[model samples]
Target: MNVPSNRPWPRAAWLTLAGVVVLFFIYWSTVASTVAIWRRSETFAHGFLIFPISAWLIWQRRREIAALTPVPDWRGLILLAVLGLAWLAAEVARVLVIQQLALVAMVPALVFTLLGWRITWAMAFPLAFLLLAVPMGEFLIPPMMEFTADFTVAALRLTGIPVYREGTFFTIPSGNWSVVEGCSGLRYLIASFTLGTLYGYLTYRSLKKRLLFALASIVVPIIANGLRAYMIVMIAHLSDMRLALGVDHYIYGWVFFGVVMLLLFWIGSFWREDERVKPAPPVVEYGWGLPGGLKPMLAASLIIAGFWPAYAAYVEGLAPNNLAVRLQAPAGRNGWRLVAPVTDWRPEYKGMDASLHQTYGKDGRVVGVFLAYYRYQRQDAELINSQNVMVRQKHPVWSNVGEAAQVVELAGRPVTVIETRLRSPHQRLLVWHWNWLNGPFTVNPYWAKFYEARARLLGHWDDAAAIIVYTPYEERPENAARTLQDFLRDMLPALTAKLEQAAET
Candidate 1:
C-alpha cells in the first residue's frame, strides 16, 4: 500500500495547473477585488483562508484524484463562456459581487476543461467550497437585523419589561438599544456555515448528515445571536445601564458566538463517520504522449475565457471620459418659492458628477430637495450603491427609523418612491426618494442597475440621479407625507426637465 514518493507529474496535472494559472492572470482584477474585500471587511476576512483550505482539502484526496485518468472535456468551454459573459455583464453594470461570483466559478470550469469530469467530480466539494470566499450575503443584513430586534424585544416583553419598538430601534426602561449592522449576526452565521460545512465534510460520509449539519450550523448562530443580544440588554438593565453597554458589548458577543459554535460542532461530532482511506490502486502508464486535439481545445478554452474581459474593456472604452453635468435647481411654481435650507441634513452620495440641494416653501409648508447626479459611473461612484444611503446606521444627528416603498401620484401618474422616516432629537421628517436612470425613474435598486447596464450596452449615455424630497412633521407623519406629495405634484415636471437638461449637457 506504500505509494511512490517521487512519482513524476502527469501531463493532465501540468495542463490543469497551467490553465488555472492562466485563468488567474486573465481575471486577476476580479481576484484582486475579492482579496481587497477580505482585507477590509472583518466579516469576510475568512475569505483569505478559503483557497488555501480548498487546496489542502484537494491534497488530502490526492490519491483518489491521481488514480483517475484525464480526459479533457469540451463542455467546460461552454461553461467558461457562459461564466465569462456573466462576468462581463456584471463588470459593465459595476456589480462587484456578481463579477466575483462569475470569476470564482471560472476556476472550476477551467479545472474541468483541463483535467476532465472524473477528476473534477472527485474534487467537487473542494472546488465548490471555494465559492465561500465570495463576499456575499450583505443583502441578508437588513432582515437579520430586523429579526434580531424583534426577537430581543419579544423576549424582553416576555420577561415583563415594557418595550417600545420603532423599526430596528427600541427603547426600554433601562436604556435605548438599536440593532445596527454589527449586531445583525451575519458574521456569526457566515462563520458557522463555513466551519460547519468543512467539519461535516470531514466528519460524516452521508450527504444527508452533512446537509443537516450544515443547516444546523446556519440556524444555531442566528438564534444564538438573538439570545446574545437579549442577554446583553438584560446585563445592562440589571447593572443599571452600567455593564454590556461599552466595548464589553462586542466582547461578550464574540465570546458567546464562540461557545455556540463549539457546542454545534460537539453535537455534530456525535454522528461522525470518519473518512477511511483505502489502498491506492496500481498506476497506469500513459507515457509522455500528448492526447490528440488537446492543444486546440486548450487554446479554445483560453480564448473563450479571455474574450469577455476584452470585449468589456472595449465597451467601457466607448464611454465618454469627461462628462460635464450642470444640475440646476428647478424653478419654484404653484406658490412654492425657493428658500434657504432650514436644517443641515443631507443624503450621503459619494463621487457624484454634480449635486444640488435646495429648499422650497409655501404658506408655512416647507420641503427640501436634494439631487445627486452621475455620468460614466464606476466603482464607489455608482448611483445604486450600499454606501449611497439616506442616513448611516448610527448617525449623530439623524436616525432612519422607518422606510418602505410607496406608490404615489406624480403628475397624475403612479410612481413608486421609497418613503423613509428620519428622526432626530428635535425634529422628525418624512422623505421620499427614487432613482432617475436616463429617462425612467425607479424606486427599486435592481431596476436602476438594469437601466444603467441597458443604457451602456445600447451605447446610450448612462446618466443617472438620486432625487430626494423631505419635509418636517410635528404630530403625524401623514402630514409630512402630504407635504412631500404636494411638493412633488407641483414640481415633478420642472424636476424632470432639469434632470433631462443636465443629461443632455
Candidate 2:
C-alpha cells in the first residue's frame, strides 16, 4: 500500500508535543489563582494536586503518545476560548479558583481532540485527575463531619466523660465544650484529602497503591480529627474545659494527621509493588534542530515575560477583594440593653486586658457573646488569648454554634472580632479582623501568635478571652450602634458564658 504524501507524519510524535503544551498552558493560567485561594482555605490549598497527578497520568501514556505525529490543529482554540471564557468569567465574578478548577482539564482534552487523538478508555484516569482541582470536596463535608463527630463522642464517653452529641456537635457536662462547625472536621478533611492525593500520586508508582493511598487520605483525616476532638473533650472533661484551646486543636489535628499518614504509607509499602518502567531511548528519524525559526517564538516568550509583571498587577487589581470590612449595622443607638450579659468573670492573661459578655433576649434565651480585648500594639499572644476565649463559648458551653470570627483591620492595623449569633435555632460564629484604620498589613503573624496562645490555654476555651475589635466609624454612629445591638442580641449567651468560664478558670 502506498502511503499518501498528504498524510501527516506518524501519530505518536504529534500527541506528545500537543499534550505537553496543553498541560503547561492548563497549569499556567491557574497558577496565580491557585496560590491565592490556597492561602485562604484548605479547600483551595488541596487544589494543588491537579498538576502533579495529571503529570503522572500523562507519564503513564508517554509511550503511546510518543508514537503519534505532531499536528497543531487550530480547532482546539475554539474550545480553549470557551473554557477560558468560563474560567475568566468565574474569576471576574469573584468565584474561588477551586470552583473553576475543572476548567483546567479541558485544555488537554481540547488539544487531544484537535490533534486527532482518539479519546480512548485509557484516557479516563488522566481526565479524572484533572477534575481534582475543582472545589468538589464540599459534598463530602457532611459525611466527614458525621464520622468525626461520632468517633469523637464515642471516645469522649469511653474516657468516662459525660457527653451528649447531636448531629455535628456534642456537649460535655463538666464545662461548656461544644463541638461546632469549625470543629466539625470540614477544613481538616479537605486539607487531608488534598495532601493525601498529592502524596499518593507522587510517591506511589502502583495504581492500586495510589488509589488506596488516596482513599486513606480521605479517611485518615476524618479519623485523626475525631481523635483530636476526642482528646480536646477528654481534657475539657478532666479540667472543666480547661483544655479547650482555640486554634491549638487545628495544629494538633494536623500533627496527628501527619503521623497517621506516615503510618498508612508504611503499611502500604509492605503490600504494594512498584510498577514504573524505565523508558526506552528516543529514536531520531528526520533531522530537526529548533526548525531554524525559533526567534519568533523566543521573541514572543521574552515579550510575554517583560509584560508579565504589569499583567499580574492588573490581574490582581481585577481580582475580587473579599477581606474588606462592611459594617451591616447602624451605630449611635443606645436603646439596646444586654438581655443576656455573659460576663461574670475575667480570665487572666499575662499582658492582655480581657472582657467577655453575653447578651440575651427578654425571654432569657441565649443571644450571643461579645468578647473583646486590647493587647498593646504588636503584643500578639494577648490578642490570641482573647480570641480563644470566644471560640470556646460556642460549643458545649452553649448548644448553639458555627465558626467564630471575621478578620478585618482597624484603620490599616490588624484587628479581629469573635462573632456568634442565634439567628434561628442554630449558633453562628464569625471570625473577623479589624485593621488599625491606617494602611495595608498582614494578619498571619497575629494568627500564628493566637494559635500559640490557644495551645498554651491547653483546651480551655474559657481561660482565653473572646476577642472582637470594633471599628468605630464617626460617620455612621447609628449604624455602629445598631450593629452593636444586633451583634449583642445574637451572641449574648456566648459572651456571658465566656466571662463566667474565665472567672471559674
Candidate 3:
C-alpha cells in the first residue's frame, strides 16, 4: 500500500467538510445575525476577519493537523448536545451575545466529533480565539465613559485647573466639554485586548505570561485614554480652542496606542517560550464511516437547537403587527388636566405601534407625560432601544444627554431613568424617562429583549412601554427636579395602573 502511515489526511478532510455542513445547518440563524451585527456595528467589524485568520492559523500547521486520526470521540457528541441546548435557551431568551458564543463554540465540538481529540487539542486556541469576533463588549461603554470623565477631571485638578463637572459634562476655563461616546476610548480598549490576546497566544507558551500581558493590554489603554483626554483639554486650553480643537487629541490617541502596543510586543519578546514539537508519525488506521456516531448526534442537535426558535416564530406570528395599545387622557387629579402637546421639543419614540404625549399642569408646575406602548417588542418598535431615547443625537437644543443615568425609587421600586436638562435660547426643560418591559422598569436593551423573550416562552402577552416625564423649568435644576418628583408622586400610581390595564386589554 502506498499510503502515508503518519497522516489521516484523506478521511479527516471529508469528515471535516461534513461537520461544517451539519453545524451551519443547526446554527444558521445565529450565523446570519452575527454577520449582520458585524456589518452594522463599527465596534464589531473585526468579526469578518476571524474566520480567515483562523483558517490561516490552521493552514500554518497542516502537517501537524494531518498526523491525527479519526478516533470518533463520543464525549464530543455530549458536549455538542449541551451547547445546542444552551443555544436554544439563548434563542428563546433573545440574548444575542450568549447565542453568538454558543454558535462559535460549536466549531470545536464539530471538529472533535469529526476528527477526535488529537485534532481538537491542536486547534483549540484558534477555535476559542474566534470568540473575540462576537459583539460582546458594548456593555462596557457607559462605565468607560464615566471612568474617562473622572480621570480627566482629576488630572485637571492636579494641574491647578478649576473644573466644574455634572454627569459627563464639564466646564473648563476655555470652554465646556462633554465626554461623548467616541471619546470613551472603548475602541482603543477593544483593539488592545484583541491584539494582546492573539499576541499572547502566538508569542508565549506560559499561561501566566500570557495573562499578565493581556492585563497590561487592558489597563494601559484605559489609563492612557484618560491621559489622552487630559492632554487634549490642555492643548485646547493652551491654544485657546484653536489647534487641538481642530486636530486635537484623537490623532494623538492612535499614535500613543500604536507606540504602547509596539512596546508591549517588544517587552513580551523577552520571556517567550517556544512550545512547538516535531512529533514522530503515528501508526496508520483506516476505515472512514459516519464519525463519532455523528449522524445520530447531528440529528439530535438539530432537533434540540431548532425547537425554540421555531416555537418563537410561531408565537410571534400569532400577534398582528397592526395591534396597538389604546391610550387616552388619565383622569384629572389635584388640578392636573391634560393639555395639548404645547412644548416645542417633544420626546420621540418613532415606529412605536402606539403612543400618547400630553402636558399636565398643577400650581405652576407643568409636566409633560409620554407613554410609548408596544404590543410586541421586535425590530424598530421596542421600549429599550438606543434609537428611541428621550432626546435624539440630532436634536438642536439637547445633544448632551447625561452619560450617568439615574436610578430612583419610584413608589418603592427601583426604576432606572435618564435625567437630562435641555437648555434653549428662551427656556429650559428637565426630562426623566424609563422603559417598562412587561412588569418592571429597565434601562438596558439586552434585558428588555430577555424579558420579552421570556414572556413569549411562557405564553404571556409580549407587551412593553416607556414612561417619560418632563417639564419646563426656567429656574434652577433643583426646582425642576422637585416639581418633577412631586408630579411623579401624585401621578405615577394612577398612571402606571392605567398603563398596565392598557397592556392587559
Candidate 4:
C-alpha cells in the first residue's frame, strides 16, 4: 500500500477528524461501555476487530477518496440533532443497546455533515460497517434456543431414540441435556454474519450477489448450528454420555462450525467476482484553506452533537437522593395466613432499594410473594434489567425450563404477567411476574423502561417494583396455576394498597 503524505491534509478531513474526536469525548461513557462488553462477552468479542476492519476498508478506498473534493452540508446538523435526542432517550431509559447504536450513528452523521454527500457516499460502507460493533441480538436467544431444541429432539426421535423435552431442557436415555445460553448459537450467528458480510463485500462487487451471500451467511449458520447440535447429541448418546458432555461439547461445536464455514466459503467461491484494481485517478486541486461558512456549520454541528449528553447529564443530576425505603408485607386475609416460605427458590433480582418475601398458606396449598422495589432508578440499579431474571443459566440449585407471557385477572382487570416455569432435581415451580411502574402493571421490559423514562423526564417519582408470585407443584402445573390465581384474587387488592402506600411514603 502506497502512503499519501506528500499533499497537505484536506480541510474536510481535518474537520471530520475534529468532529469525530469531539464525539468520542462527549460520549466517552457509551464508548467505554461498548468496549467493556466486547472485552467481557465472548459473543461480542468480534467487536474489537470491527473498527480495524472498517479502517482497512477505508484505506483501500483512499485513492478514490483523495480524488474528490469535500463540501460541508448543513443538513447533517439535522441528523446530528435527531441522533442526539435518540441518545438522550436511551440514556434516560438506561437502554444500553440503544445508547450504543445512537453513539455509533453520530459518526456517519458527522462525516456527512463535514464532508458533504459525495465524500460521505465514497466512504459509506466503512461508516455503515461500524454498526456491527454494537453488542445486540440477545432477544434472539430464546427463539434460537427453541429452534435448536426442536431440531435436536426431532432428529433424535427419527433416529429411533426416545426423548422427552420441556422447553429448552430435554432428556434421553443416556443422560440429560439442557440448551442454555451457550447452546443458543448466538455467537455462531453473529460471527458468521459479520465474517460473511465482510467476505461478500470483498469477493463480490455486484449488489445482488453480495446480498445473496450475506443472506446465505445468516441462514447457513442457523441451520448449521441446528445440525451441529444434533450431531453433538448423537455423539453423547452413542458414547453412553462419555463424550461431548463437558469440555469437548464446546470443542466439537466449534470444530463442526469451522468445517461448515469452510464448506460454505468453498461453495460461494465458485461465484466470486474479484475486483480488478485500476490506476488511481488524479487528485483534485483545490484551496487547502477551509471554505467560507464551513466554520459556522462545523460549529453548529458540534453544538447539536454535544447538546444531548449535556442535557442527559442535567437530567441525571435531577434524580433525587436515595431515600431509606421500607416495604411492609401484605396482610394475610380470607383464611390465607402468612407463613414461612415453603421452598428456597427466589427470583434473581439485584440492586433493589427494598425487597419483601413472604409465603401464604391456605389449606394444603402454599403461595410465595416477592417484591423488588426501586426509587430513583439509574444504571445498574434499575428495575427493568437483563440481570434481573427468574434464574441465572448457571445456577446450581435451579433451572428455568420454560417462560412466556400470560394474561390473568388481577383486581377484576386482565393483566399480562411473565409466566415462568422452574425445575430443580427435587422441586418444580410455576411463577408469574410483572413490573409495577408507578401504578400501572406491565410485563414488557420496553414498556417499563418507557414508563420510567417518562416519569423521570416529566419530573415525577421514578418509582418501580418487580412483583413475583409463585407456587410449588408436584405433577400438574395447572393445579399450581390455580392455586396462584386463587391466592392473587383474594390478595391482590391488599398487595396493591401496600405498594401504593409505600410509593406515597
Per-residue error (Å), model 4, residue 107: 0.6
Candidate 3's residue-wise lDDT over 1-505, tens digit each?
1222343467556656666776676577788889999999877888898888888888877778766665555566677778766776566555678888987887787677656677778788788878888888766877888899999999999999999996677898899888877888888888889889888988888779889989989998999889888888888899898866655466777887788789878988898888768765574543332433445544554555466567657766666546757776587687787766547787768667778777888876789988888886665566655567656653667654353478777887666787877765567778888787756877776777778767766766678888888887765877887888888877888778878888776
Prediction 3 global C-alpha lDDT: 0.75
> Which residue pairs in candidate 4 collide?
none
Please give, for residues 193-238, the per-residue lDDT of candidate 2 as tens digits: 6666656755776778788888887777777777887776676567
Give TM-scores for every candidate, taking all chains together and pairing residue i with residue i: 0.93, 0.46, 0.86, 0.94
Looking at model 3, the pairs that clash are none
| TM-score head-to-head 3 vs 4, winner | 4
Candidate structures ordered by lDDT, highest first? 1, 4, 3, 2
Alpha-carbon lDDT of model 2: 0.47
lDDT of 1 by residue, 332-440 (tens): 9999999888777889999999999999999999999999999888888899899999999889989988888999988788999999988899888888999888777
lDDT of model 3, residue 441: 79
Candidate 4 achieves a global lDDT of 0.86
Model 1 misplaced stretches (Cα beyond 4 Å) = 1-9, 276-291
Please state the error at residue 262 of candidate 2 in Å.
1.0
* True lDDT of residue 233, candidate 1: 97
What CA root-mean-square deviation does each model show from the true structure?
4.0, 14.9, 4.3, 4.0
